[model samples]
Target: MKTLTYVSTKSVNDLTWPTTYDNTNIYSSALSVLTDFQTAGPRVIESNTRADELVQLMKKEHVRMKIVVDTHNHFVGVISLEDLSEDVFIKQVAEGYKRSELMVADLMRPKETLLALSYTSLKNSDIESLLYSQRENTLQHLLVIDEGTKTIRGLISSNDIVRQLRLDVDVAFSSFEHTYHSAILGQKFQSRSLKVA
Candidate 1:
């Protein structure tokens, strides 16, 4: 029999967490800000999940969006915190549907209405270029597609960009659309500063 040695925990005061790319500068690869499904699994929910349940889960996890899937786990659509806003629920209730009966699919952005960027293109781009290209759009989350594999690869969130770059703008009280616009504006100012230096 072999005996295993145990280390003392008394002196260990710090915990280690996983880290991604060390260089988070604007010129760094756009992938640095992406939540890659290949590396970290995508956040998903079943289409039939109750709206209230989805809201609770999102709030508890501090996630603003989730990919909607079917029983077979195929991506069908996406749902965001904005989609389940109190206003939307109130409107639905006014239309005669009970709150308890609402499902995620009822408010999700269908797959047909969504757009995705090619993984190949994202790999060749930098954060500055990516933000510049998407400056006019209000989409909170941009999905990445691996066209060659015919699969959903990952997503880039406006919040993630704001956090990763340590931007001065506060996103907590801002809507996703506002946050996206703010991030773009912040990036532009930063780019100009870099040029002036």
Candidate 2:
């Protein structure tokens, strides 16, 4: 009996330090994407907005998360759809309370929350794990803040990740494959009339 010639190559995989993306670079500007809220971030509630209004904003943004702010725009608390599931809001609406009458303060989680800064370096694995640990399986949105003021400076979403990866993949497999090592993605942070970081 004769055996066909065969060849196999052995390979080893090694762990690498996660690549970081500065949230300051990836986050959407406070003045741009935050069309829903005129102030800065999705924080301020008109102090007159109803629960229905909040729900509508959440649905429209497709974020399902919100940060409540006082009239001074001071960060107050956070509101999440989970807080007002059918169990609570339904009962209140049935009792004839308008969404406007329900202040965001009344329905928001405590001020202590998982806040982050715009300049912070975001590691993909760490962020992903953080969200999972909070029981948030897939993070559609994450807020980037100003470390000095704890104020929101911008926002980030999963789509951004996909966009970046696609860009990188394209460059890696292109004609410049031999020079791909020099194609690093570096981010410079800036905002209107100021250095964001």
Candidate 3:
């Protein structure tokens, strides 16, 4: 194994807001999640990757979704927990074999919903607001990418953003906004119910 250390400068480009929607001001550089600890950075899949390969890898790692990168290293699409859940849904529909029997191609949904670009502020809400909104929504994950390359640079699920902000469930509950928190709120709501309620 090889380890490489490089110096990086912190900039606004590196900054990200938490799900709080409170605009509490979180510097993306403040905390480095596992996403930053990666050596090759993050696990990536080619467009041609088989559904079976992705399913096995995701299940093994307990991952709900992944970013799709092409041979040119260009961002193509996103895969979500809902997309992966297709395997289980499929099995339920067929009542035939286990979900493990399905492949990524057969199950993974095409990348559709998105949260591209880190610098782009979400809902123009504060940190707390963002969190509440994300939780109430139907999306399970949100991807942050480079606007120019459109390549995924980071992903922030309602869970990921919440954990980063260290917000409490009670606090989140007291501040849930019914409007202007669509994407964030919608996604979280989806995960908890596994349905876009």
Candidate 4:
């Protein structure tokens, strides 16, 4: 058997800690969910990423939404698979916008127009409150913003909520406007059934 002794260097400076954490134990709660960027990290794409490339990326990643960031990696907007569809591209071409020239920035919904919920607010809320807010806003995806940092903290999806609650939720909406409408209406029907029983 051989034994070795380890010694620490006398002058170790400028060492840095890892910024990443293991996310295995994260879960959903009445306070807030774990799917937020603070926990799961944001799925981001560059603003200059081509629309065609975006479609391929989404398919490869098995993701429907991606956060759009600038060259400096600052959050700019968000893009969805729905926004990168062949139909959308075809329509844009019909309107004289060159398909080859389109970029993620052009296809993303500007952050200002997106619906966001405060992380602090979510901390004090329950699943029912989340459902109510989703219904009221007709939102399939809700961005959680940290009030102190004023930065995106995470995302909450209607389907995720349904899965967590073990409810059968069909979120197949025809358009952006219909996304949450169906969920809200479904919740209403569930409420009515509970009342009748």
Candidate 5:
């Protein structure tokens, strides 16, 4: 056995906080904003969870989105705080379903209808170009796929990008469609105006 020496804590005044890439502008690399699952685990929820319960849990945990999984933990879909909003539940109630009977799978964006960006492509791009390319997509959260491993690598959130870059754009909570039209399209238009000026 080797002898080990213990250091004194007398001089330690502060703890080092972990830091991510500083995304101070739109030109920052797209990878900088990715919530890589390999590093930080994805927030997930079960498909059979109650919608109202999920809303309360999300609010309490301060989580805005969660990857939905089946009982076997297989990826099934994704659900955002917006997915469990009052209007959505009300719509289901109109369709003859009881409010308390709604499940997360009912409102989640199913995997079949989702699209993802390849990790390789994202690594070579910047935030501005990425957003410009996705201007036509009605997405608030974008998944990143690892083509080589054939697995989900991570995700990017429009809200995170907007916050990190401090963009003067509003991502309305009314609906994902409205957010796409107003925020993404607005960015595209803003860029065009800047070029003209």
Candidate 6:
């Protein structure tokens, strides 16, 4: 009698990261893809937070954006790292405000100008339409408000959308893709002639 032994040709080291698209979710809804507030609430910093402290927090969190809040814990405005580093520092220095004296309230885009989309609108709309709207508005972030509660339900960002789609969706959104990256990651920071009040 003759016996044969089998040798395995594959090992764990031969494996590679998955490049396959998530074919199961070809059609997705806004609610399905959006970064819900419950999942990742906006990063918050006090209005009086020092510029240096803000930078340290951002580095620690690996985030480029934050929401400014007052001592009462009410939302006051929003600030991005680009605004802090590019616009604030230069403007403050030029105006003779010491760097150590700089605060987030001085650099934020105040809540009075907050722009948003209704939750109903987002629920009924598609990603392409949203991208076009964001591009037209030149916004990196758009709040979604629940009309019934009159409260912010979620936030959408170009970075989040791009990251979600990269997993599986293969449609060509050439112009939108460009707009998304540029709006979010691009350094187009500009200083206002006068400080925001």
lDDT by residue (13-130, candidate 6, tens digit) is 6767744345313145656556667666767889999977888888788777787889998878888777777566878899999888988988888989887788898888766566
lDDT of 2 by residue, 99-189 (tens): 4577666666656755543434432224332323323223334565556655566654434433443334332123222112212222211
Candidate 5 whole-model C-alpha lDDT, 0 to 1: 0.82
Where does candidate 5 stray beyond 4 Å?
1-10, 170-197
Report how far off residue 51 is in candidate 2 (Å).
1.1
The lDDT of model 3 is: 0.51
lDDT of 4 at 88: 92
Q: Which candidate leads the pack in TM-score? A: 1
Q: Which stretches of candidate 4 lie over 4 Å from their true place?
A: 1-34, 136-138, 171-197
Clashes of each: 0, 3, 34, 2, 0, 0
Per-residue lDDT of 44-102 in model 1, one digit per residue for the tens?
99999999889999999998889999999999999999899999999999999999999
Cα error, candidate 4, residue 5 (Å): 18
Q: Score candidate 4 by lDDT.
A: 0.71
Error of model 3, residue 45, in angstroms: 1.4
Q: Backbone clash tally for model 1?
A: 0
TM-score of 6: 0.69
lDDT string for model 4 (29-144, tens) is 43443376655778999999888888998999978888899999998899888788899999989999999899999888988888687888888776655655555555456678
| Error of model 1, residue 166, in angstroms | 0.9
Candidate 2: C-alpha RMSD after superposition: 19.9
State the TM-score for model 1. 0.85
Task: Pick the winner on TM-score between candidates 1 and 4.
Answer: 1
Per-candidate TM-scores read: 0.85, 0.43, 0.49, 0.73, 0.80, 0.69
**Residue 168 displacement (Å), model 2:** 18
Give the true-structure RMSD of model 1: 3.4
User: Model 3 over residues 91-117: C-alpha lDDT tens digits?
Assistant: 555877555455444454455644443
Better of 4 and 6 by lDDT: 4
Best by lDDT: 1
Candidates 1 and 2 compared: the better one by TM-score is: 1
Query: Ranking by lDDT, best first?
Result: 1, 5, 4, 6, 3, 2
Full-model lDDT for every candidate: 0.85, 0.48, 0.51, 0.71, 0.82, 0.68
